[model samples]
Each structure stands twice: as C-alpha cells, then as structure tokens.
Target: MEKRMIHLDETDLAILELLQEDARITNVALANQLKMAPSAMLERVRKLEEKGVVKGYSAAIDPLAVNRELLVFIFIKTKDSFANDKSARALAAIPQVMEVHHIAGDDCYLVKARLSGPMELMEMKRSKFSKIPNIISMRTTIVLETVKESSHISIEK
Candidate 1:
C-alpha cells in the first residue's frame, strides 16, 4: 500500500518537535510553550494524530538499567530472498530481537538484539535461532561502545 502525504503547518511541526522531546508534556504546558490557547493546541495535536503525522507515544527505557547491556548486530543470510517471510516473521517473534531490517548487499536481514551477556547470546543462537528455517548463516558483531543513540526524527513543515 502507498502512503498518503500529509501537510503540516508551523504549529504542527512545533508540536511534533516538542512532543518528541517529552511525550509526557501536558496539553496546557504545550500550549504555553507555543503561546497558543490550550483548546487550539489540543485540536492541532488531535489532527496531527488523525493525519498520522504523530504515530504514537512511547517511553525511552535505559537498556543498562534493565540488564540488557550487551548489544549485537546480527547480519543474517537467508535462502530464496525471503519470498515466503516465514523465517523473517519467526525471527521477529523472539523477545530479544529489537529491530530487524531487510537489508541490501550480501546479507538478507540485519537484526539488532539485546542480551544480558555472552551466555544468553550463546543460548539464543543454539535454541532460538537454530529453530528458524531458511536461515543460512549469521555473522554477529558486538558493540564495544555506543557514542550516541536516539529515536527522535527532525520534523519539518
């Protein structure tokens, strides 16, 4: 399906930037920041959601605090170019798999996973990954240090 392009005004863009920074910001507070009435601000926000500009809100959790310190990027090679997507969907069902992308180049998929430590990684490979069909091979790259990570997108009018 093709996506319908939605136009956003300056106010809508402002709301998006502010909301991205702090999703918990109250509507009255948001209105004060943009110097608009609360009702007007709320209506604009509602429209933004209806138009699909504002997808949804979520909290950012600290991976370390949750004991998910080990970060690894797994480059997966699959057979048949994943025409059926059975293997792709099965890989996604695992709890540790954070992000999966159908990538170009030598590999078919690039998967981001979080684990407690090396032991869990080994267990995932043996028990979880070994069950998925059509997975030809996987090359794991452990992250030594993360300079920066963010989910915020620059909203433009």
Candidate 2:
C-alpha cells in the first residue's frame, strides 16, 4: 500500500507541544489549557493518532535511579551473511541491549546497552557477542555523562 503524509496545522502543532510536555494530561485539562472544548480536543487527538503524528505514550524512567550503571554505544560490523534471521535472534537474546539501529555508512549496526560496569560489558562481549556467527568486528564506547536526553519531537510545522 502507498503511504500518505499528513500535514499539521498550527493548532495541531500546539496540541502536540502540550502533549509532549505531559502525555498524562487529561483531555479536559488539555482542552482548558488550549482554550478548546473537551470534545473538540478529543477529536483532534484522535485525528493526530490516526495520522501517526502521536505514535504512542511512554513513561520516561530514570536509569540511574534503577541502578543502571554504564551506558555503552556499540558499533557493530557484521558479515554480509549474518543479515538473515540468525543475527536478529542473537541480538534479541541479549538482555543488556536497550536499542539497536540499522545504520548507514561503514557500521552495519549501532547498539545501545546499559550494564553494571566494565566487567559486565567485557563478559557480554566475550560470551554472547563472540558466539554470534559471522560477526566481523564490534567497537564499543562508554558514555561518561549525558549532556542532554529528550524524546520530544521538534515539529517544524
């Protein structure tokens, strides 16, 4: 099926801005803040969802608060043959993995992981990562500090 792109007006943009600030805001409260009727506000929200503007809501959790120690970015170079089901299965079994992106350019994939310390990272590399078939190489970088982290989409409309 052909995909259709939805254009957002100023009102839609405003609604998105408010929602990004607080996803849990009730429709009534949101309507009051936006100076629109609750029903109208609800309709706009439903339209946004239908158009895929508002993908989904999620609770932002503090990694440090939960004893998540190390944040590592791993650049992976996989053999061409590994792109099939085996590579995906190998990646899925790793519990420390937070996110994986299929990247362009030299690196085949970029993997984000949270672990306890260097020891855990090393163990993961030695055991699970090494065992993955047709992995050419893996480069890892530790994040000392995060300057900024945000999920808010900057709407240019």
Candidate 3:
C-alpha cells in the first residue's frame, strides 16, 4: 500500500474528533454542534470518506455477551520469510482472528484472536492454525483484564 500525507483543515479535524467520540452522530446534530449548515457538514464528511480519512462505522460488540470472552495474542514464528504473506493470509482467513501484524525480531506475525474459552482456543490451535502451512511455533498470551481498548486515533483540535 502506498502511504501519502493527507492535508486536513480545522473543520476536517473537528469533524473527525466528533465522529471519533460518537460514530452514530447524526449529520444534522453534528452540524448543529459545529455551528455549520447540515449540507456543508455532509459534504465535508463525504470528502473525508473519499479521502480515506473516515472509514466505515459499526457498533462495538461486547465480547463476553457474544461468548468470545477470551482475548488471546499469539506470537507466531513461521518457516517462511518475514516478507511472505502466506501465513498472514491464512491467519486472516480465520473468523476468530481479529488482527494480524507482521512484526520485527524473532516473531514473524502477531495475531489477536477471540475465543469462547481456553478449550476452544486449544481446539482452534489444533484444528485450524495447525493446518496452516509454514508455522514454526506459537506463543499465546491471554488478557486478564482490558485496561484500555479503543479504535479511535487522535485528531487535531
């Protein structure tokens, strides 16, 4: 993917900040808060979406309610080169796997997975992950408690 610097004005920043706080905020309400016309606010939001500054919005689900109470971060060491996407693609294909990061040092990939319990995690490892090619080893870490977890990024005021 190509990386480029996106120039954002104060209005754009403000809009992003507001959206970050409440993704479900209405266009009229947002415009009212920002003291701008609703149409103008809509246009700005559209521009933000087009520029890829604003991604799609969705409701945040409670993992416990969904029976995905266990949050596990697995550090994966693969037989393939770090640049290879084979293992990453395979991991990404799994529905339980949330995020996959190609990292530095001994570990090739770090995967975030949600499971019902320890038994389900072990079963997933034995059935799903173990079937994937080029996996050398894996180290799993379970989260005891979530101190902070948010997808929002800081926007200039």
Candidate 4:
C-alpha cells in the first residue's frame, strides 16, 4: 500500500487517543465520549483505518503469564548491505523477536526478543541467529527491569 500523509483535526486526535487507551471501546460509547453521532464516529474510525492510522486491533497479553519473563535487546552488526538485508528479514521471522529496527552507528539492526529465560536466549543465539548469514557480531543485553514499556502513544487533543 502507498503511504501518504493525512491531516488530522481535533476530533481525529481525540479518537486516536481513546482508541490507544482502549481499542475495544464500542462505537456508541466512543461517540458518547466525543459527543458525536455513532455513525460519524464509525466513519472517522473507518477513515483512520483506510489511512493506515489504526493498523489493527490486538489483545495485549502479559509476558510473565506466558512464561516470557526475559526481555533481551541484541545489537547485530552485519557485513552485508544494511538496506534490504535478508538477515534482517530472517531475524524478524523468529517467533520470539518482538521488534526489529534498522539502526545507525556501529550496529546494523537492534532486535528485541522475549524469552522464557537465559537458557532460551542462549538456545536462540546458538540455533537461530548463528545460522543467519552475514551476521558479523551480536551483542546481547538482558533487561533486568522494565520501568515502563508500552505501545500506547499520546495524541494531542
């Protein structure tokens, strides 16, 4: 899909803020909160979706509940071209890989992964990451504690 810029008014920002806070909010409830008609609210949400603003709704799960207690950030340096590298795609393909970003400076990519424990991390490094070609070096940092981690963004009203 082609990405294009879309101008947002105060209402659009309000809608985004509410959705970010609680995506499961019904159209009627949302419209009530915004003091707008339900049909108008629905249309706004539809436009947001069409513009790729509201990508998709998802259930937020607790990592600890799922036995994924360890959060590790790995900085990967590659010998291959940084742009459109197959290694980055391979890293992203891993089930445990939560986020992958092409970064500047020494590292080509910064990868975030959640694991059950250190053993699982070691296993992943040995079995999965080691096999990806052009990986010159990988530096793993285990997060001892997360002060705040959220996908939520504050939209100005």
* lDDT (tens digit, per residue) of candidate 1 on 3-114: 8877777888899999999999999999999999999999999999988888899999999999999999999998855456777788899999998888889998999999
Q: Write the per-residue lDDT of candidate 2 for residues 29-105, one digit (tens) a residue.
A: 98999899999999999999988889999999888787677999999888855345466557767999987776788
The residue-level lDDT of candidate 3 at 109 comes to 93
Backbone clash pairs for candidate 3 read none
TM-scores for all predictions = 0.92, 0.84, 0.95, 0.95
Clashes of each: 0, 0, 0, 0
* Local accuracy of candidate 3 as per-residue lDDT tens digits, 34-111: 999999999999999998989889888999899999999999999987567998999999999999999998999999
TM-score of 3: 0.95
In candidate 4, the residue pairs with backbone N, CA or C atoms under 3 Å apart (3 or more residues apart, or in different chains) clash, namely none
The true-versus-predicted C-alpha distance at residue 30 of model 4, in Å, is 0.6
Better of 1 and 4 by lDDT: 4
How big is the positional error of residue 147 in model 3, measured in Å on the Cα after superposition?
1.0
Local error of candidate 4 at residue 68 (angstroms): 0.2
